[model samples]
Target: MITVKNVTFRYKGNEETALNEISLTVVNHDFVGIIGTSGAGKSTLAMALNGVIPHEFAGDFYGEVLIDDEDTVDHAAEYFGRKVGEVFQDIDSQMVASVVEDEILFGLENFGIPHEEIGIRLEKVLRELGIEDLRHREIASLSGGQKQKVAIAAILALEPEILVLDEPTGELDPESSQEIFGLLKKLNEEKGITVVIVEQKIKLLCEYVKHLVVLDRGKLQFDGVPREVITHIDTFKRLGINVPPVAELSAMFRADGSYAGDVTLTVEEAEKMVREVLHDSV
Candidate 1:
């Protein structure tokens, strides 16, 4: 479990507070999504979760972030890194090696995993990510989507209990973005890893994550299940966060008392609700 209590931070040489008394809890195996406008502190919060805020980033920080009962401030950045893996927005910047196999091997080798066990873990992660064919491919030769997978595979090899990603799909096309979310969902459900993702793609978050968090100007704006949180359509609009079209349609029907069903997060759900309403009218 992750506990963030009354945490606040300010970057060095910057007067503005990057985070303000933000407190949240992510239980084991929870899939949480953070969304907000640009400069909303989304990336800052992701860094905090992975022990970068107080340890690496030179900042004035207050409060505490605890991972599994241990305080993050008391340890070095690399300490929590073993338990929490982070993937940044730019996959290329995270790459430390030229080839895919070397990239995955680097983390295991650094952590002092036994030499004999390294191959097993590397093969497991490569197969888990379905990137075994790209094991020998040069990192620069892979497409944007492939590079993103390799970045994730390298992290997964570490067997971290919690995975934090800051806009992992920000550079990808719509199709690639969906594929990454699907992969995260699979890891969360099957491997039982806790996943925290900062994404601008509200529709994908709603479809995959069990909980939704919204941050604005370094403040905790909203935190709840996606269905409950999306109902604040006016607030989302005021904050300039996009609501899925299907959710908008569902809210429209609910506003007029035409459809008393749940808020639809996906197109298929909206279609079913629409057919129900039409059938009733007939």
Candidate 2:
């Protein structure tokens, strides 16, 4: 479990606080998505989760971030990094090796894992990400989605309990975005890894994340189940955040008293509701 308690932070030389007394909890195996407009501190919060806020960045940070009751401030970022693996928004910035297999091998070797076990971990993570075929491929030759996958595979090779990603699919197309979200869901359910992702795609979050957190100008605005949070359509609009299209459609119907159900987060849910209403009318 991760506990963020009333955390406030301001970067050195910056007058504005990047995070303001934010408090939240993420339990074991939770798949969480953070969404907000630009300068909303979404990326800052992701840094806090992985112990990068107070450790790597020069800043005035107040309050506590605990992982399973362990205080993050007491340890170096690298220490917590072993348990909370982070993938940055820029996939290329984190790549250290030329080949996919060597990239995954880099972390294991640096951690001083036995040479015999390196290959085992490498094969396992590749298979887990379904990227075994790309093992021998050059990092420069991979596409955006494939590069993102390789970046994630490199992190997953370390077997962190918590995976915090800062806009992993920002550059990918819609189909590729869905594939990444689906893969994260699979990892959360199958490996029981706690996933925290900062995503701009509202529809993807609604479909995959168990919880959604919204931030605005360094303050947390909304935090709850995606369906419930997206119900505040007006608030989202005020914040310049986009509500999922299906959710907007459901809200439109509800306004006219034609739909009596909760906000629909997905197209399938909307379709089912329509079918039910049609059946009742007939």
Candidate 3:
């Protein structure tokens, strides 16, 4: 659904590029996770995906970013808005409406969607995101998790094919973060919404995402299946990115010549692998 080719961007008066010749493709229904330390250009890359880099921010950009086969850099902001839906880390900053339902319907109403259709979409989004209980609640009264869900419902109401979230769970507690991540996984699996999330919670992402893209110093350092990326514990550690705990434990067992099977990224998989190894040895 999106293609970035040889893309590079440099801010004004800055000597270094925020993004350096990065290239990647996001297909339909793919759950892609991007991880990097502070100033590693993860957030900049997210902005570039939706044409916010050069258009919204002053910068020199080179190369092409195509959304649904259209050149994002050449198109207007409104055009990209329809193809991409963005949820920033700060829910307060992205929210424009006071009530949850109004916020969800705000974008659709702006685009001239009929009032009747807006009502239907509002209900559908509320239910789909499991935020029905928050429908009439004031935005200011919501918890961090509820607020984030409402924010996501607002973006989902646009019905964009691609959902780009920058640390969507950054402000929530662990339970709320888990809830939000579960919804994202369901959306990707059932609705086929292509998801690109720039997150610091590596362990949560490892549980659901199909692909992992690692960035370092404004460049693509790794891109592949989740397990493959997780297996590189030393490399990830050196880059200041945390490896999944399960993957780290599996690696330790492997080094000791005790684990003979595949590396695991989840707790369930790790438990099964360890049980099998112990049973066989005994």
Candidate 4:
């Protein structure tokens, strides 16, 4: 549904490129994850995909970004905003409404949807995220996770074809982070919306996202399965990407020939691996 070709960008007055010759495509209903260490260009790539790079942030942009075969540069930021729903790590920065329901309504109204339809969109989005009870509450009163979910609901109300999230759970506790990822997975798998998430929580993403892309120093260093990227412990260390604890444990088993399978990226997979080793010993 999206294509990026040989795209390189540098902020005005900056000598270095934020992204270098990056190219990739995402198909309909695809769940993709992009990961890298700080200053690796992951966030820059996300903004570029969502039409925020050159449209809102000035830069020396090179190459093109296309959505559904339409040149993103040809469209305004508002146009791409409807095609792509972006949830940033800082929910407050994205939110504008005082009430939860109004938060969802804001997008619909901006899209010029009819007044009657705004109500329908609001109800559907609140139900989809199961935040209906919080509709009347003040946005400032909600917790971090609740605020994040409301942020997502606001974007989801727009009914964008693709959802792009930048570290959506970076500030949440582990349980809340898990909930956020679970909601995103449900949206991708059950609702069939394309999802692109740039996150550092590789293990959570590995559990839900099948395709992974890795970046290093503004370069596309790796693109494939998360298991493939995480198993190369030495490379991950060199690139300053953290290998999840489960992946490290599985790596030890593989080194000893006690486990022979793809590298595990989630706790569930690690648990299954442990059970297999015990059964073999029995």
Candidate 5:
């Protein structure tokens, strides 16, 4: 659903490029997670996916970004806006309305969606995002998690094909972060929405995302299955990102010659592998 080809961008009066010949493809309905340390160009890459590179930010650009076979550089921002829905790290910055219902309807209204249809989309989004009870509540009164949900509902109301999130859980507590991750998983699995999330929370992301992409200093470092990425625990540590707890434990056992099986990335899988090893040894 998205493609970047020889894409490189440098800010004005800057000596270095934020992205260095970066190229990636996200297929339809794939859930991709991007990880990296601070200043790793993760956010810059996310912006390029939806045409926020040269279009919204002034900079020198080389290469093409295509979404659904249309070139983002050639098209207008309004055209790109309809195809991609973005949720930023700060929920407050994304909010344009005071009430939940108004916030959800804001995008649809801007797109010139009809008045009657706006009501239908708003209801569907509220129900799908599990915010129906919050429909009439004040945005200021909602909790952090609720605020994030409302932000997501507002984006989903646009009916975009791809959802791009920049640290959606950055400001929330652990419990609230889990809630946001769960909603992203549901949206990707049940609704078949293409998801691309840039996050620092590797442990939570490993639970849901099918693919992982790591960046370092504006370069693509790793892009593959979650299991494969986590197997190199040392590399992840060096990059200042944590391996899933299960993966770390499994690695320890492997190092001690206690288990010689496949690397596990989830809690359940790690448990099963360890149990078999113990049983064999007995």
Candidate 6:
């Protein structure tokens, strides 16, 4: 549902491009994860997906970004905003309304979605995110995970077909982070919403995201299934991704000829593999 073609973008005064000749395609119902070191263009790529690049950032943007076969450059930010919902790493930056209900309503109001439909949408999103009780809570009173859910709820009420998240769980605890990921996964798998996330938390991400895209120095280095991508452990390090301990152990096992099956990217998978291997040895 999304296509980026040889896109190169540079800030007005910067000599180097933030994104250089990057091309990618994401189909409908795809859950794609983007990972890389700082300045690798992961966030820049996310902006491009939803027209935040040329429209909001305003750079020397070259090439094309298309959503649903429609070139993003041809439309205004509002147009693309209707098609893509974006949640950034910082919860504070995304909040406008103090109360949770108004926070969710802000986007729907801006979009001119019917007022009658607004309440329904708001209620649905809050219920779906399991934050209905927080409808009247103050944004500042909520915890990091709660704020994250509110941020997502605000965008979700807009009912956009695609969701783009940049380090969404960056400020949350481990349990909270897992909850956020679980919500996103449910939105993707059950609702068929195309989900794309740019994250540095590879260990947590590897367990949920089915597809992985790696960037290096503003270029696409790798794109494939996460389990398969983890097998190329050295490439991840070269790209500056911190390989999770589980992934590292899986790679070491493969190298020693003790585990020849597909790479494991999650703790559950690793545990199952270890148990099976030990049983066979006994």
Instruction: Report, for every candidate in turn, its global Cα lDDT versus the true structure.
Output: 0.93, 0.92, 0.87, 0.88, 0.88, 0.88
- How well does each candidate superpose onto the true structure, as a TM-score? 0.97, 0.96, 0.95, 0.94, 0.95, 0.95
Clash count, predicted structure 6:
0
Runs in model 1 lying further than 4 Å from the true structure: none
For each predicted model, how many residue pairs clash, with residues at least 3 apart or on different chains?
A: 0, 0, 0, 0, 0, 0
Q: Relative to the unseen true structure, what is the C-alpha lDDT of residue 52 in candidate 5, on a scale of 0 to 100?
A: 79
Candidate 6 lDDT by residue in tens digits, 139-190: 9999989989999999988888999999988888899989988999999999
Candidate 2, superposed: residue stretches over 4 Å from native = 276-282
Residue-level lDDT of model 2, residues 133-216, one tens digit each, is: 999999999999999999999999989999999999999999999999999999999899999999998988988999999999
Per lDDT, the best of the predicted structures is 1
lDDT digits (tens) for residues 124-226 of candidate 3: 9988987788899999999988888888888889898899999988877889999988999999989989999999899987887999899998999989888
Tens-place lDDT per residue, model 1, 5-120, is 99999999989898999999999999999999999999899999978887878989999999998999888889988799999877778789999999999999998889999999
Clashing pairs in 5: none
What TM-score would candidate 3 get against the native? Answer: 0.95
Question: lDDT, candidate 3, residue 17?
Answer: 92
Measured on C-alpha atoms, candidate 5 has an lDDT of 0.88
Candidate that beats the other on lDDT, 1 or 3, i.e. the better one: 1
Q: How should the candidates be ordered by TM-score, best one leading? A: 1, 2, 3, 5, 6, 4
**What lDDT, from 0 to 1, does candidate 6 have?**
0.88
Model 5: per-residue lDDT, tens digit, 48-159?
Answer: 9888778888888998899988999888767887678888767798799999998887889889989989989989999898889999999999998898889888888998
Cα deviation of 195 in candidate 5 (Å)? Answer: 0.8
Evaluation by TM-score, superior candidate among 3 and 4:
3
